[model samples]
Target: MHVDVIPVGAGHITQDIARGLLTPVDHAERLKTYYGAAMQSPTDDREMIDVPQLGETGPAEDITSQLPRSVLTGVIQPRIEETLELVRDYLEAGGFDGIGARRVVLTGGGAQMPGIRELAQTILGKQVRIGRPCRVVGLADATAGPAFATCTGLLLYDQMAPLELSDERQTEAKEQPKGRLARMGRWFKENF
Candidate 1:
């Protein structure tokens, strides 16, 4: 099952706090760094050779190996630890009991992060997973990844809404018996 993981910003806190603190630029930069770090997977040179078969090929550094473990453990891991703690708190506080959730979805481009789902599951204690758009008629390739999930979901949402008043009025007009005056108006509209 596909899952959508939305981004959390200062806005996730409270509107007042969000408005008081981070600006749009700050929020954007935070999201960029969060997503960038999440996508970075540790791989040695040997692993790089195998990646080519999957369409990934380039000079790469094994971040896990290259970075000092002390620094990573002190800084990186702590941040992840903090975030996970926050997620746990949020879920408990919000009361999101995992009922009928087959797979927890993490969507958005950020969902592509290498081990985020595992981290999230560990923290949230749920059957967590990532979600991607799939199996649409015209939007097959366009809605392929987590990044496109929101847009694809929105398009699907629009399709499911009831007809507007304008549409209902038009349908009513189509179904009604046309008097001579209405026919004359229709003829004039068509000719014009």
Candidate 2:
């Protein structure tokens, strides 16, 4: 169970908007919701997003502006490529030698974006699948997509207790090599 965590996330889209937009938009929370919907089915055409009370002092008025799809795709696609590249580098570096290394399971809000699976497969030259919570009980269908994966995983993790080693096992662990591989193995054992 060798795992590599990449830091790129949905928040990056909001950051990109702040930097890439011609006119500054200060409402990140609203923008996240707006852009998140747009990302679900991205296209080449520009979109109009309406923001209410866009000004600081004037009476409430909705501001409609054009948001180019390139803004979202430009930020997202490259990050996905970068993530796959990192995984490739890890495999080449001999950090991950697990079974089914060529198969990638993408989970999280970003995974639901249209074309992401195809893009990842093309970039990684591997099979990629959107991950969902499996073997979960009492999970609503509405909340069962990749967006809720982290939360479901956390709930599952909460039920797990730390492994307790016996004196003999502790002695054997103490004798193991203190290296990167050893640490990773120990972590895998502890968590999984």
Candidate 3:
């Protein structure tokens, strides 16, 4: 019997950005992709961004919505911090508190943010690094990023699992004896 399950991935940095910016999700998403970071650095403050407006009398070429990079930093920082706090709470409540000193890998789309490694390490008290797909032969360039690491890992694991041991375990489980009395009970019940 086969069952389909959706695995939950960690983090929602984009959604947090979307809510904080008071912009449509699509526009907010582009802002986050182009300019989002865990904090504002000196270099970031020098940049200005033009974003799409979702307001009525629609988007016009001359009326582009503009904001300083620092404003973006301000908007996203609290939300990212709150998200990190929730991640900490989740790990602790799930009895993973001992991982404090271990190295944690941040993968997937949000890991591409400029300061995520430093931010995660600061908040989670663990060494954090960005992880991308590795050891995949003939992997297309498009799917070789951090976002694809999980699926690549699953594929790799499926290829490498020790099948004989798994088969032995399954055989042993299926053939377990019910014992003489239990077998007799089943026999009597079936016959009756």
Candidate 4:
């Protein structure tokens, strides 16, 4: 199996806020809350986000700014399309173009945003689904969504034992003469 990854995170939204609103963010955590609430729906309506002022002398006042939906359509959506296009180009160059036809699973906090899956589907021309953490034991209900998928995956991965070659494979590996090319190929096959 071959997996291609694209880095799309909540930080992109924060950057978009800074760029679009032309405001330096003081409290990122508080801004994230506003982003989460504002992106609950895929609408053209403008949202009011209370952003903390950064370069203040004495007291800091919250800057109430109107967040236009263009942030989603103009900046965020274009970035997603560009990333997917890059992935498609990479797969094509590697002769794995057919892999692009498979369904896309959008994971992490950005996947929970409204209309993100639909936007991805439209861009990639493939079925898209928001991926949530699965088979997580004792996972709290609040953390069972796509936002916690990365954490759950890390926990699951940490619990897994390292893969060991079988006795037969170990014997075959030892019997083969270790040339530089052979060693390089073995390293690639093992890691990749």
Summarize candidate 4's per-residue lDDT along 68-166 as a digit string, tens digits.
544434545555556657655765676555754577676777676656676667666667788788866687888889888767877887788565889
Worst-scoring 10-residue span by lDDT in model 3: 1-10
**Candidate 1 local lDDT, 121-173, one digit each (tens):** 87677887677776678776856888787678778778888656697798977
Deviating ranges (above 4 Å) for candidate 2: 22-43, 46-61, 94-100, 139-142, 157-164, 167-192
Score candidate 2 by TM-score against the native: 0.61
Ten-residue segment with the worst summed lDDT in candidate 4? 31-40
Report the lDDT of model 2 for residue 165: 91
Off by over 4 Å in 3: 1-12, 58-62, 99-101, 163-192
Query: What is the TM-score of each predicted model, taking all chains together?
Result: 0.46, 0.61, 0.71, 0.62
- Residue 45 C-alpha lDDT in model 4: 49
Candidate 1 colliding pairs: 3-105, 3-131, 5-106, 5-107, 104-129
Backbone clashes per model, in order?
5, 0, 0, 0
lDDT of 3 by residue, 1-192 (tens): 111222332245555555665566776778888898887799767788876554536553344567788888787777677767766776666666684436667777767878878888899897777878876788888888878877897888789895556877888747856789977877788799
Best by lDDT: 3
Off by over 4 Å in 4: 26-33, 36-53, 57-61, 67-73, 93-96, 157-162, 166-192
Residue-level lDDT of model 2, residues 76-104, one tens digit each, is: 55656666677666665764434557787
